[model samples]
Target: MHSDPSGSTDRIEKDIVINATRERVWSTLVTFFWVDEGNLGTIDPKAGDRFVAHSAKEGSFPITIEKADHPSLLSYRWASAQEGAEPGEGNSTLVEFTLTERQDGSTLLHVVESGFASLPSAMAERAVSDNTYGWEEQLDALKKSVEG
Candidate 1:
């Protein structure tokens, strides 16, 4: 978690090591928890693609891809505060996933989500707090899913 002196979170960063190859982790990640997994066959992600990430406990979030580089990096803009709204100029945050493969075939997965400071103060505070917890749980889930 990265925050300013006033304790407002403008960015969130987390990394975890998964006992799996980078390629395997990447495939699982790109397809993780979408309500509609139909189009995610092996999840060959690309820039400009749009999708919704759904969680039964958290509803749906609109996502627009910004970058995708093979099994290494994937980044997107997401409207997490305004659920179901399209991500755009002032309403979204950038979320990036970076993967590094180790010599032992394991993977180091790092995630960074930034741009919350651009949102309304209260909203930014809530979004940052909620997502701070969310990432911890999500990463644990990802590790379990991939390692299995």
Candidate 2:
């Protein structure tokens, strides 16, 4: 977790070591976002690709791919304020996933979501708390999905 002195932005980060190859972990992440989430359409895994993630529980939010490095790093920005607003410094949060292959045929996956400070103080606090728990569950699910 990261916080600025001005409370303008906060970060939530979680990492997991998966007993699987980098390719497997990456594939699982793609599926988790595109399939299980049922929000992202056909992902091209390229920067500038625009997508939407919709869920009954989470609602719909627009996302823009910020960076894509095959089997290593993938990052996107999601609107955290308004549903259809463009993801940017003040209106959205950036989610980044980094995968590192280990010598033991496993991979370490790290996820960081930042930019909560742009939102209202109460909303930012709630999002941080909610996502803290959400990330934990999601990472556990990812580990199971990839390791099993």
Candidate 3:
């Protein structure tokens, strides 16, 4: 088990090691599992790029990519699913992925989701809980995606 944040988690994070290299994990994060658009549009094996996540859900705002550190880290702002941007409104949240290397040469992935503090209290809590669970699922998803 991992250490859970001991407080109001306006932000949440999780980590896991995959049986692969950082380069391979990078590919899976950019071109595969996560959506490609907006911030997640352009990603390379370096810093200073934006990676956005597109939405297939009706009215779900896209996550804006913010920063990256090659095969090590990627950060973005996650948008709200509830605040359906009608005409002009936009919802922005914080999201980040960090990759670490193990002595065994496997890859370790860490994910952090932030900025939900701005959401409505009820919604924020739900988003936190949901994502906490959601990331667990996705961590498994990514693990399988890369290891397979």
Among these predictions, the greatest lDDT belongs to 1
Pairs of residues clashing in candidate 2: 8-117
The models' CA-based lDDT, in order, is: 0.84, 0.77, 0.65
TM-score of each candidate structure, all chains considered together: 0.89, 0.83, 0.73
lDDT ranking, best first:
1, 2, 3
Tens-place lDDT per residue, model 2, 47-137, is 9987676767667777788998978999988875465577776667888999999999999999999888766666677777777888898
lDDT tens digits, residues 1-148, model 3?
1233445666787889999999888888876344432334334534333333445643344444567677787776555545444211234556788898888989989888877666656666667777787789778887887889
Write down the worst ten-residue block by lDDT for model 3.
83-92
Q: Which residue pairs in model 3 clash with each other?
A: 39-51, 39-52, 40-51, 40-52, 78-93
The number of the candidate with the highest TM-score is 1
Candidate 3 TM-score versus the reference: 0.73
